[model samples]
Target: MASLLPYGDVDFSLRAMAGRAEGFGRNAIGGLHGPLYFVTTLADDGPGSLRAGCRRKEPLWIVFEVSGTIHLSSYLSVSSYKTIDGRGQSIKLTGKGLRLKECEHIIVCNLQFEGGRGHDVDGIQIKPNSRHIWIDRCSLRDYDDGLIDITRQSTDITVSRCYFAQHDKTMLIGADPSHIGDRCIRVTIHHCFFDGTRQRQPRLRFGKVHLYNNYTRNWGIYAVCASVESQIYSQCNIYEAGIKKKTFEFYTEKAADKAEQKSGTIISEGDMFLNGAQPCLQTQHTEGCNMFHPSEYYPIWTMEPPSHSFKDVLQICAGWQSVCRPAEISTNLD
Candidate 1:
């Protein structure tokens, strides 16, 4: 029995009502008959901020419409059907962080999350039993673990068209292998870019993952690390100068076996150059993995901005752009 609060009609700024709403429940902000609780990120031209008081079973719709940045130092958890829409604006969540636990039909879109100099600060964390979650068109930077992490029975989740940079890990799905079978999770990652220059390569363990048309550049380690029993079906993916193509070199033996089961084309060279020199892998143990290189003759293509499948579903249009240098291009590794 969760209460419903529609923010589509309210007009309260998150900055103006920060202290007043701290510890305020649904009855205080929205009143008993209030249809919604509106929260904005603009506060006296300073850092627009909002802090949700401890809540038990309330459904909230929070909108981040601030001009500058917003820091959420405390935990804000909502019930089923709650929505947080950033409207493609720049709203940052810093400090303690946001927790969406046991929530269903949740939507978090078009925002930025910056975890401060704290440890274990995650941009958006989906706790166990949180189902039907949608995180789209968000940009996240500077976190301890990753921009977004889904674990513990979090099923039917969608993370699309997001950009992640300057984090220890980019994106993660499922907890440690010891926690397997405690959750049934399915994740779809599309059209996202991972820049792992600061950290080791990004890893995704456990669950069934569908990774399509993602671009990774300048990462220290591998692109993705799928678990032993995990089913990772990736297609039309591009990885540039990462440690390994799909698995870290340490897990080569296990990753090779998994790559054999889930088949697809992995383009290790730059997308701007896809010529006959490009290597395609049908299995994990195939030789000549390093002989091929991506060419700069391929055409440049742009997909719809917010759609993760835009690159995979859309067709290429114009000529290729020579962005990478020849010497840099020659050093393409899997």
Candidate 2:
């Protein structure tokens, strides 16, 4: 890979491993701990199949030996202490998606999720009470619901270096404004590519979210958003607005401000933009909402922006090539 930054900067690529004591380089280690579970075929066996490796009780590394697409007939339920590795294979999930419900210590990497539709069809649903989760280097698009929904007290999540394209309501951090459990959701989204996505990239609600070093291009409605007691720390991101697009409110504050209305807080610093006439426009809000710093959780995090342009780095590093597919596999085999 080409050098993306200046000589001495905390590598933007390292953002995936920011909070972990052991670094997560490139791929998120989903079930790569105790034992190795090689997915020998591309067959769907409901929750008993390879699609549901994260639901396994024992600690194991779920790896794909077979290279093909697994079209699900139902949602795949994930368990804790699992790593789903799709490297060295062309693994694609379609027609359905994964659900992480109250699970912990999970990682999902190097998979392609396409055309996921039907009910509850988020690419990845991080449900309530989940913790220590890392979702990295995946390709998510064309889902019926939001691509990713981190809701209901889900915390300690890191979503990085993935490619999100051709979608609307792309990523929803919280379930809804009324879901009170969403306040405990702490997530880190960094170095990802949001390309041609329609909206909600992503709509955050009631979470302490750290968003940094992401490259967004041609969003239909807005790039970043906050509502309902959410605290967003946005730093060092690049937005390339769509030409001929009327709205320039790259950063949006959802819901109207009122004296009795609950509000969300967004602290913006060190961001870049192109063709966005109204980037980072601070809107009206109710007072007394608490603001946060990324260092409160990630003490190693810095406010300093990247030394080089993300445009140059993202062209070669973002998406499936650098994030997923460590080795080439036969996509035509499926």
Candidate 3:
């Protein structure tokens, strides 16, 4: 077991044990208490750019900085009271971004994750028995599965201010459908953006998911789905940019098949701004405990001004040109 104290010292001996790859270096820096270990890749090479490291039982503070892409083909597990801060840096982890397996008191912040080519190359995979985890300000895109997945006994997890895009399946919280285990509980998602053009909207399987102030555009399906016994508090969510379908649909078969579930509610209190240029679909759901409330607004149409006639028309078009005509109109008319 690794010690969580002596926060500032870097143990060079642990480098070899942690499997430091080529082109990456590990150093210990003084932090709050014990030494804090920072693993960095100084090169911009191809595939194998990041150094691989793990903490099973000991406490650690790991930082990965990649100028280019990096791949972690295996699990990057962090134990209790550990902090994995990427410091608003970019990292392309070809496999799982950070796997919290049966751990507690873990915090992951300021990292970007790009998935691998496999089926389960998720940004973060939380296994059963993990608790009190906080994932904040991270960006996850282009994955086969969801960006962040919580399963088994995971509970009390919070995800905020993140951006998820180009995922076949976006955020998922609960046990795998095939596996029979305890459900995920007490999860919160706030102030995030989900651009799900590739797949359906973000989903929550089996937990209490609080979603507020999220922006979803160009989504293929419902912006939010709560299948199992989950309570979703949705407010100030701009769904579908008034282009695609507006209704929130539930897969009733999937919801009913889940063990002893309760249908959730959708609360829309604030402005549901819709650009009248696109058609809108009424919100829909299974007939039961589910509910939908939409704010009333006059659908506003944004009209594009007529094309410029000539220099005479151009003079009249100058003052309002900024907001009226297309940006290319100026150069074209000139």
Model 2 scores a C-alpha lDDT of: 0.69
TM-score between candidate 2 and the true structure = 0.82
lDDT (tens digit, per residue) of candidate 3 on 1-334: 2211111121222211121110000111111122345556633233323233345345555555444465665656666656555553554555556677877766665567776456666778888778777665577787666678888767766665567777767777665444434343656564456655444345655455555445566666556666554445555445554344544534332443456435444444442443321322224432454332211111221111222222122222211011111111122112
| Candidate 3: C-alpha RMSD after superposition | 16.3
Prediction-by-prediction clash tally: 4, 10, 12
Q: Kindly list the per-residue Cα lDDT of model 1 for residues 253-294, writing each as its tens digit.
A: 222323443211233322321212123334552333332111
Error of 2 at 6 (Å): 14
Off by over 4 Å in 2: 1-32, 46-49, 243-259, 283-287, 302-309, 322-334
TM-score of 1: 0.61
Give TM per candidate: 0.61, 0.82, 0.64
Error of 3 at 84 (Å): 1.3
How well is each residue in 1-334 modelled by candidate 2, as lDDT tens digits?
4434311221222222222422112223344445667687788874335865656688766777678789888888888777776666778899889888878778776788999988678888889788888876788999999898888888878887789998989998877755767778888887788989988777887778887777888888777777777787778887778852422222233333323455576776777766752454455532455687766555454234543454667655555542232332233112
lDDT of 3: 0.49
Error of 3 at 141 (Å): 0.9
Give per-residue lDDT, candidate 1, residue 175.
65
lDDT of each model, Cα atoms only? Answer: 0.47, 0.69, 0.49
Best by TM-score: 2
